[model samples]
Target chain A: MIKLNSNLMIHQYFCLMIRYLKKQNFWFVFTPYFWLVLFFFIPLALIFKISISVSEWGMPPYRDLFSLSEEGFKIDSTLSNYLFIFSDPFYIRSYLNSLSLAFTSTILCLVIGYPIAFYVAKSHANIRIILLVLLIIPFWTSFLLRVYAWKVLLQGSGIINSILIHLGFITEPISMLHNHYAVILGVVYTYLPFMILPLYGYLVKFDLNLIDAANDLGAKPVNTFLKVILPLSLPGIIAGSMLVFIPVVGEFVIPEMLGGSDKLYFGKIIWDEFFVNRDWPVASALAMSGIVILVFPIVIFQLMYAKYNFKNE
Target chain B: MQNTILRMNKLFFKIFTLTIGFSFLYFPILTLIAYSFNDNKRVMVWKGFSFRWYKELFQNEQILEAFYTSIKIASLSATFATIMGVMIGFSLTRISKIPARPFFIFLSSSPLVMPEIILGLSLLLFFISSNHIIGFPSSKGQLTVLISHITFSVAFVAVIIQSRLSSYDKNIEEAAQDLGTIPNMIFWKITAPVILPSIISGWLLAFTLSLDDLVVASFTTGPGANTLPIVVFSKVRLGLSPEVNALSAIIMLIVVLAAISVYFINRSHIKK
Candidate 1:
């Protein structure tokens, strides 16, 4: 009787172990993939399928857009939609405009963000915390409201103009609103925090001894900064640029609000195509083109970054 | 003469950097806050001071409803995203035998690099297809919005938790197991305590992302369900008002206070 009972106990123990292993296996294998499929992969696949498939309704209104033929006929393939975007001067210009704006804003962000990051990194603990909070506080407001405020300030009869006119600085308002400069300013303003935080992360762990060594070696301050600080901080610059550039490429609201009706941007164009024109195909084509243009450079940068160690500084 | 020139250059650089940084970061925000108190219904004109706009904003039923909806979606999505994040983090860190760990990591991080518009459009298409075939998610509404938020928010949470886990010591868990503790008990009693702070921080971060989101919400939100950012965007597109400014100021205040409180709390704990 004792032997039988011990045998049964061993069997139960084996069963329990198997159950535990199964649970672990399920969690490790099944669960992550399940969520990824449901959330990520499926959605991406759906987008591709939607963009490619022929519209059941007669040439969904978006298809007729940018057509030189004027027949309003829809083509089911990806090439024609892409061709339309590429062939059109308006679309091509918008892409170039977005690129320039993103590049400029990123450079502006780097110029503005680096010192603040350096200061915060070198500051006393209490001051650092306070400065960090100050940096983040502006982010809490709706981005839309902030853009609108810029509109008020930059408008013809706006506060900025009123002040300038009262002071006799200029005879008229500077035509700040609804201009390319306003769009760039808005983009730079909105994305500055993104630039600062990454730079701050890199700067925080930066070694001060290198700068001291460079100075002791008789390098001028500018030379020291150029030779020592800049190269050492390249990772932060790259990361910050990526952060600012990627989002700015797809930004719609800022340009729409501040750029006014006349200014054309890829984001505004895509928004118009998708929502107003109901042209999913062309919008998808534009979106896909954007992804293609960005992905290649990003991959190249990543490869280069991985090949070299900028973290040693 | 050389020393004076160097000093002047340094001073100029310092002033220039500070001016540029502050103007870029703070001007728009300060302008909005200032305009909120301008007492003028016209955004372009500064009349006087009055709290009437704030009163009007509070009374606007649409704004209030949108605010509540945003809070609800943010809370729910943040909670679920944190859970998924923790799970993914645990899988990546704990399960060494798991194949393709790097692939999973890449897959998770890919969303972070993708543009918001693409993500939004893709998710919308996904929902429409899934609804047609599966017959589940019978209608799109809060459920769709929350699901979409969680999809992106989880990646952020996972990134945070994974970094935290990488830095955590493993000996504590090993010691617990050697003391005849079961895996479940060891996880609950030891791993959970060590990682709880990260989990909380991840949740808070996810919540903030969900709250601040505009683009994704625009794509996923169904008819009659508007988030706060969307409402604010539409209103501002029409015209800016002090009420919008007041609303923004209140949000800014809350976020600042909460962040400071968290910082102090964390610092005190470290001191202890």
Candidate 2:
């Protein structure tokens, strides 16, 4: 509607460029993508690159990914690291131990956390927030301290032993601290919040009138929970279980503090390989295989779930 | 009469179950605080009630220095992570034209579930390679740790921010544009104010995560950049110390206060 001249065209073009640069949408997409690709994705790629490299005793402790030898062009790579990992009984046992530990701890968490989450969700509106705050406060506290709390409780001369002795439960203190069970105890204690929070997220939104109607229709309490509550909260159960299971498989600190030599885990193996053995190739291979063993299944499940939901929709 | 008795029994059962569950949750916390008051050098042995460990904790330089380092790193990392996280969050929810959206989403969210040990090792290796090739970050210290912390915590902050943005009403921004407000003005004025609570919460969450991290920090830390968790873990791994108990009590109190304040603030915002 206004004037259109040569000068106006130049001015409008400059303004368009300026506006494009200043757009929030442009900044939002560019900034995070750049940083994430640079730091996270590239590093993972580097881990992959080094994992395939040959193990050597040197300053970075691994041979180069590619080298110009007597041959014109050479890509010096080996699958031997992965082969060694698969061949070693210690490595195989550790992986199996981690899976078993993760499975046991996840089941324990669900068993313990379900009731707590349900109770809090069923509480009066005013009291629910207070209880949730109480739950969150513990989670926000030092994780190391929380794990140490178990150490204090399970030590041979610790509170559990003292209480048991006092209560005439047992005369001699049972060795509780440095064992596989202690590791399970520590994982469950520390990760209980992770399970409960997500479960509560799903449960709190649930319509209670369904339960009332089920009961009115002659369904017992157990039957009502089985039919009405459990199916509706299945998604939360899966989400919470995955959250706990995945991390515990790769857990290092809990075992180090609480577990004895009775069991070893994938995480501790990677740690030992890196620092204790100074084997970068083996450590990277372990991590890569961990990504394969743990994450691949989760990704597959997620993709299948999304596709199934899409098809149904 | 029978129905009333049945109701009473049900009520008692629920209450009993809740009591047992909550007790299990609180038992360890209570014992930790109680032992902090124990006077003996031996943490389990109760010589008498005294403030010796608390007094010693105050004078301990190593603990205090690590505490200082943790706070500094956390604050810095949280601020940087929040900025990057807000961008990721806004892009995912508010914009639709992003390139490689799926890959971006994967990168941002995968860290939330990735094992800390793997992440730490990868970052350390990356840094070493980076130093070897480029002449930057020649050594691992607070800076390297900060970079690693920000990289991981950004995912958490982005998650918090993403949820907030997705649930937000877009009509307000549309209405602002109807009044002839520019896009930039509308975003800065309207969107920023609406998402301010999320931004603050994201920052706080990032801070907590950075401070609490041990496994990752341990992998990335150099000789001079020991974090609180790393220091505490080293001490606790060897044996129990009452001074650590005292220190833990203090940390719990501070965390509790911060959580309460956040709860009240969030509640008030929801009410509004």
Candidate 3:
């Protein structure tokens, strides 16, 4: 019995030593792994399960969310939800509309943001600080409130029309509100800061010596900017594009408020499916499709970005 | 002479860009501010200057309720998010030997990249399932809203704290440990002080994000759980109102003041 007790004691000491070694070398690594599993991985796994099981379990009030049948069934899986999305003219049109709006707004933001970022970076130190503050002040306001405010200004009886009529720029109030133009304008306004900040981050680190060298080599100012500055700023452009484009694709509020009933976007369609129609399966399917489409481009961009250390360049 | 012309052309381009850009950025906000003071029954028509709309905004009960709700949620969510973020940040930085660190980083940031509507929908579905299977999350209300806010806000806080932590020196904590200080004590005394600025900024960011969010709030909120953004959104959908303008102006004013204070505080701290 004494020998057995001593053997147990020896085993306990060996375990303690192992634990201490792990604490010294592996604690940092293990703790984060545990946290990621607990908080992020588990929740995402649950999301995937819910998406897959909606048809099987009859969750979310309505059943067979993925199929045309109202009755919940386990007989077969159908791609009707996805097929319907593509075949339906309304859904296809909304998708196209949203894509175009996001594209145009992204381009507009780039055009407007790049030069301002350039100027702010090149300006004197105090002026740069002041300009940056000016840029950020508008951002501090509630983004929703800002969008709502834009709605007021664009409405027929709103401030813009009133000012235009008073100034004799138009004899009659133009129907500016609740249209494609308003949606594009709101998107560009909201995302402009996103574009500018990344560009500014890039431009601040840009070497002026490159431009000076190009000029000394007898390159014209336009050519120097196109050759030296633009190439260097490509990373910022890509980052800014992702930042703006990704969210704009799923934007519901700006389109809902400004695009009026005349236009429909993908976000509104998804909202309608879930809330108004109570079709959870179809909504989940739509969301999954959007994820699939968006992830492809993002993955490609990230691969290219990694291949070239674009930010550092 | 050629250089002078080239310089003039560049200057012209700069001015043109600045004018167009600033006008687009500032016009709507400026219009909102100006119209709030206009003394007219109709929102668009300007009669004269008045503070009537501001008074009306204060008098509205629903609007006041919304303001209170938004403030409460923002404060609660920011606090919770900051605590979780600090833990995650500590784990990522100090606990370096963990397997799959890059994957963890990607997972945490994935929420940020995902569209808000999708995140909201997925969370809503998740909560519904949990309520059914586990009998927890009895209903989606203030608690659910707070949890959802924390879920996203924590990621932002984690990113911010991680950035701050990367710049922190590890030797300070090691020295504290060498003196036989407890790990938690070393964290509180040595590490927390160094990262306090980042903690505050993270908290503020989370607060603003919760306050500004509409889509997620829409999905998670039950009846009587209206946030300020939802109240304003529903009202805007009905029609334009001067009270909304007044409310926006007040909100913007508070934000600007807070930002200025933060800027000064940061500057002074840097000087020190």
Model 1, C-alpha of A138: deviation from truth (Å): 2.1
Q: Write the per-residue lDDT of candidate 3 for residues B140-234, one digit (tens) a residue.
A: 78887887888888877987887678666788888999999998799789889999999999999899999999998888888778989889889
> TM-scores across all candidates?
0.87, 0.93, 0.86
Best by TM-score: 2
lDDT accuracy of residue A31 in candidate 1:
70
True contacts kept of each: 0.46, 0.68, 0.44
lDDT tens per residue, model 2, A1-313: 3556877987876777566557545665678778878888898899999899998888988889888878777898999999999999999999999999999999999999998898889889988998899888878888899999999989889999999999999999999988999999999999999899989988998998999899999998899999999999987888788889888889999999999998888999999999999999999999999988887646743553333222311
Between candidates 2 and 3, which one is better according to DockQ?
A: 2
Residue A286 lDDT, candidate 3, scale 0-100: 72
Clashing pairs in 3: A28-B95, A29-B97, A29-B98
- Which sequence of candidate numbers ranks them by lDDT, best first? 2, 3, 1
Q: Candidate 1 regions off by >4 Å?
A: A1-25, A28-32, A56-78, A297-313, B1-16
- Per-residue lDDT for B88-186 in model 1, tens only? 878767776555555666666666667787778777767766786797677778888898898888877987787677667887888888899999898
| lDDT score, candidate 3 | 0.79
Question: Which candidate has the highest DockQ of all?
Answer: 2
- TM for candidate 1 is 0.87
